[model samples]
Target: MADDRRLEVLSAIVTDYVRTREPVGSRALVERYRLGVSPATIRNDMAALEDEGYIHQPHTSAGRVPTEKGYRLFVDEVARIRPLSAPERAAISALLTGAVDLEQVVLRTVRVLAQLTGQLAVVEYPSLRLTSLRHLELVALAPARLLMVIITDTGRVEQRTITLMGDRPDPGDDGAHGVIDPVALERLKIRLNASLVGRRADDVAPALAGLAEQAPSDERALLAAVTGELIAALRPDAEERIAVAGTANLARATPDFTTMGPLLDAIEEQVVLLRLLSGDPADASGMRVSIGSENHEDALAEASVVTAGYGPGVGDAVAHLGIIGPTRMDYPATMAAVRAVARYLSRFLAGPQD
Candidate 1:
């Protein structure tokens, strides 16, 4: 019973401190919350919490504020991370559903997240290597020019324009004009799909290595150009990309940070943000929270990050999204916003594309 009451006092301190950005005294806690106990008893509980390293008094005469330990305990024990309200869910769904492609979806998602949490938001784009090819379309724009459309299972689409080169004109074309035969273009499309559809992005190039050789002599040059572009599109060294929003929100919490320069610089470095978001594995609730000193970067020492992975299903995270703010943040609401947005994004990616 004593332990439980102490936890309650700690929770109340965390809440009041986060809201007011001020040290909470036992008297204020008693008045603000009905602890069902006398002021002296609350003071004793506060003393116990402080001794245990969960909270501390910054100034000898001032009231108490929660330490990082206290915040972690509050997040793990006392905070109830509830789902977003029906209207909130509807709003997110409506916003995400309107996106036309993968790029738009990511941009819109980061904006929505930043708005919901009032904090800096980061979203890692789905890794191409993890996605399978869903469809491939080839259109003959002209005899020497073709449009190649590649669609992935995660609804990512890439288009490339290939210019045919070599000594041969298409089968039905006069030597004067570099026109491709319609019948041959259609046949190449069918063959390319047969050889490459459903393969992982990393395997695309290898699967198409001998494809040009298999085509008829007159069509080999066109096939080779198309395959080369496809291979380049799915190169292994392709840099991973991330989207970020709400830097102004960080500026609002300037008082909480020791120095804002390093933090701001780190945010601009995509590689740093990606490593931070993906470093920690999530907990049972599909959430990962890094508080204060737990963060790897010196720039983030005074900040907290809440992240959740999103993908087609459980244990299949293709990428992650999260928020960064001062350690004195509202953990419950931030966790809920991250979880909710991640769920919506997962459903969006798993669904069929237009």
Candidate 2:
């Protein structure tokens, strides 16, 4: 019972600190919260918490503020994450369902997250490595060019143009010119789809290599060129894209100018943001909270990152979406916002449900 009461006092302190951005005093806690204890008792609890490194007095005679340990305990043990209201849920669905393409979806998502949480939002584009080929289309654009469209299960589309000239000259054409035969093109399309559809991006190149070697002697060169384009389209370098919004929100949340510049610069660096979001390889379809010094990045030591994975299901996170803000954030609300947005995004990317 003593431990539970101390936890309650700590929770109250965190709540008051976040709302007022001020150190919480024992008298304030006794007056504002129904702790059923005297101010002296509360002070004793505060002293014990400070000794345990959960709360600290910033000045010699000031009230107590929560330490990182205190915040972590509040997030893990004390805070209750309430479900978003009906109106909030409706707003999320309406905004996201209207996106016409992947780019728009990501753009709108970052905006919505920023607006909803009043914090910097970062979203990693769905990684092709985690998605399987949904479909592949081959359209002849000209006598020597073909437009190849690659669609993934995560609603990502990549298009590449392939030149088939010099691979095989048409029967009636000179050696310098060639035209793709419709019948051969259709056959190659079927073969390529049969070999690649439903395969992950990492497995695509190997599968295409086999298909190219097995093609008819006249079609082998054409198949090889098409496969080469497909491989390039799914290269790893193209999968590292992310969208960010609400940098200004950080300024509003953080009053300390000393750390704000470096924090803003770190946010501008995509590599640092990606590393921050992707740090937990073992985190699949769960909310991850990295608070204060726990973030490891020097610039982010004064910030907290709340992230959630979005995708088809557990163990299959296509990517991640998260918020970055000052460590003194409202953990419950921020966590709920991140979680709700991630769920809606996962459902949308999974397409129409049966």
Candidate 3:
């Protein structure tokens, strides 16, 4: 365990330096912060901290800045995250309560997170597969064709058409007789659902093929269309939609946004963003602060990330939420705001019980 007094002093120095964007010296710390010690005493503490590699002097003439180790200790031991103010909480609750759909929920979440943290915020949409199956409707358009509509708990809807074989002897235009009865159609729907319902689209085809051998002679086309459409709608090839807000904030903090062209380029890539966010689900519960030079990504080597995972719990991360900002960004405020937003988002996504 670190010394409480030292940790408190280090925390105070980090908090102060982040705000001023300048190195912190013993004299400034002593005079500015009531450390209950003289400049000389504080100077000795600073030297000891520097020797322990918790802080560093950027130049021989400079004061000191927190090193990555310093940040780690601060985050793990010294940081005290606070919830949002009641008014802010109420506003966030109202905004989230009005979300009629998942897209709106995620969009609003990213915006709210950005506003709170003053840093870039990214939110991944909840996967469709995880959503509860609300209802399924089947409509027969022709003897051989049927349309199937699937509604999810998240309020999103998908429709697909299934083609079935016709019992009509002519197999074509027979104006005199309408083939396929309502009873048969209902039975066919029941059969198809037995193999398809609640299962992922990709896994449905093989399951449906099992029932094909026993399918009604005239409903083969309808079955095929229903199965094909369901598969297409849930296809993993569909681009996972994610919402990003606060790039403007990112530009405002950095001194040379244009010069960091490569870094900006990587941030824009969806795959890269997804990989970065989803890289470690286990690290999601509390705030995980990656200071400059501590991040593994080459593009973000000079940047800092303060992130947390939000889901059912730490083990079942439903999604990721975090802020990306400069290393000099306010850690305490940013971290507090992030923790609040993450908890709020998790509650929003879980929604009220039906």
Which predicted model would earn the best TM-score?
2
lDDT of 1 by residue, 125-189 (tens): 88777778888998988767889998887877778888766465556543333456677778888
* Local lDDT at 196 for model 1: 84
Cα error of candidate 3 at position 119, Å: 0.6
Q: Given candidate 3, what's the lDDT at residue 37?
A: 68
Query: What would the TM-score be for candidate 2 when compared with the true structure?
Result: 0.90
**Alpha carbon lDDT at 212, candidate 1:** 53
The estimated TM-scores of all candidates read 0.85, 0.90, 0.78
The TM-score obtained by model 3 is 0.78
Residue 346 displacement in candidate 1 (angstroms): 1.7
Clashes of 1: 1
1 or 2, which is superior by TM-score? 2
Scored by CA lDDT, what does every candidate get?
A: 0.86, 0.84, 0.70
- Supply the global lDDT for candidate 3: 0.70
lDDT tens digits, residues 1-354, model 3? Answer: 377778877887788878887899887887788778678878888888889999999888889988877877887788766667887777677768878866787788899889878888887765555544456678877764567877654454666666554344435432323344566567777776666666644565578788776676555555555666766666666555578999999888776232566667878998867666666433434557776566677888667787766653334444567777776677777877777777777776556756
Which scores greater on TM-score, model 1 or model 3?
1
Ten contiguous residues with the weakest lDDT in model 1: 170-179
Candidate 1 TM-score over all chains jointly: 0.85
